[model samples]
Target: MNFKSILFALTTLVTLSLAIVLNPQITSPSADTKWRAGDTRTVTWDTENVTGGPIPEGMKGTIKLGYLDPKDGPNEHLNWDLGSGFDLNKGSFVVTLPSELETKRTYIIVLMGDSGNASPQFTITAAR
Candidate 1:
């Protein structure tokens, strides 16, 4: 048997097993509740559930805050603005709310990569 191939296969299996065992968390919230468009929110998140460390000293998480289309069909990506992202050492992170969103519309709060640097995932939604 090829030693290199065996080692690689073992590594992959171990990584996959770890993921299933850890079952890292996905969602987290900020301390300063109540978020409104056109206003800045000092958001925070608790990732200790997924991340095995302090709330602010855990794995980094990216937060994308934006607004979803409010109109009916025929409108797509009308006002989807990706705000400034923060590199979190913990589960919690802060973000600035956009000011050019329509009232009574739906908003999005994405917290992608709760564990690894994988594709954009882990997102939340809010409405006005």
Candidate 2:
């Protein structure tokens, strides 16, 4: 191959490698997952290729269990905060579903704070 071609390939490789190494990754709660009301499930996450860094000077992270509209942002009607002030490095935590649900509706789980991530669209069936 020509020298220019080789150099271009090398630069591309380095750029991709740095992108993966510098960005954080969320590793759990497969997309479009379903969970019933009054159920307990574990939510997991990870930071790929990341090591020690500066600790946050404020709140760590919060777990938000609620609803979202495709047009607007958050749906306050179905909003419920699962947790708050949790350590970003906690990795995983158990979440208990509400025992009662008013109606069969779609919901979502979000991890926001020092890090931001979300679960696939999930539904909460009315408790039997």
Cα-based lDDT for every prediction: 0.44, 0.62
* Residues 23-126, model 2: lDDT tens digits: 22445555556667787877776644433333334436677676666777555343666767666666666778787754444566677754455666666776
Where does model 2 exceed 4 Å of error? Answer: 1-26, 49-59, 70-78, 102-105
Model 2 lDDT, residue 98, Cα:
82
Name the runs in model 1 displaced over 4 angstroms.
Answer: 1-9, 14-34, 51-60, 67-85, 114-128
lDDT of 1 by residue, 1-128 (tens): 79999999999999975555222343433222345555555444444564444333443445555434546542333243343344564444455556554443344455454443221122232334
Estimate the Cα RMSD of every predicted model relative to the unseen true structure: 7.2, 8.5
